[model samples]
Target: MTAKAKYQEVLDLGASLNIQNGDVKEENGTLKVWGTANTPYEKNLIWDKIKAIGGESPSDIMADIKVADNSVYHRHTVKSGETLGKIAIQYYGKASKYQDIFKANSDILKNPDVIHPDQELIIPNA
Candidate 1:
């Protein structure tokens, strides 16, 4: 399965567990369930089942990419066939933002037309 698919699957499972905000706690490099809510006993049961299955917390399932100022900037390594336009679309969800990316990494990307593999490009916030 694709990485995105796997991530979604894990998120779905976590949501299925019906873990409340209070139940999830980050402790000693792992997320553990601490307490039970009064209203939803069924959610606790689901959480128990999830724990039995060795399921991790939603945060544990997420990718550990660095975020700056509440925005995650993508560090894209240029591929042989990839263009700035493609990279912009991939990162910013729009090809028009190519100039934005170009402007951000002007030092590295001397020429917008010439990009090679392993050339790290900073995809700025859209």
Candidate 2:
């Protein structure tokens, strides 16, 4: 497969993430991709996708993904029936780290257990 076709899923992921200034080009046998992500989490997601498809350090692709926000790991919108533990697990891979998430969102969250849908919570860099 052509380099571009081989990484089509990565391009699609970038589009779905609403990457800014996205550009894609295939030169020789390498795919070059550039874009700006809203947060480190999003940027990592792109790299993870690329690595998943191309291996850990594939020479077939070169991506210069930038992060627009470095203050927080991610800004997550709460969904119904989602708890801090769940969000923590999704981001930190440990449910017990919910306290950190609660503390980071203390301004908006009066209680750790109380969160409503649509509330934007900061997933602090942990």
Q: Which candidate gets the maximum TM-score versus the true structure?
A: 2
Per-residue lDDT value at 47 in model 1: 50
- lDDT values of the candidates? 0.55, 0.95
Candidate 1 residue-wise lDDT, 1-126, digit = tens = 433343443335445644344234344444443332222323334454444444555443222212222232556778889999998877656888888888988998788878889998777755
Give the lowest summed-lDDT range of ten residues in model 2. 43-52
- Model 1: lDDT of residue 35: 33
Worst 10 residues of 1 by lDDT: 61-70
**TM-score to true structure, per model:** 0.47, 0.98
**What TM-score does prediction 2 earn?**
0.98
lDDT of each residue in 1-126, candidate 2, tens digit only:
999999999999999999999999889999999989999999989999999999999999999999999999999999999999999999999999999999998999999989999999999997
Clashing pairs in 2: none
Q: Look at candidate 2 and tell me the lDDT of residue 119.
A: 98
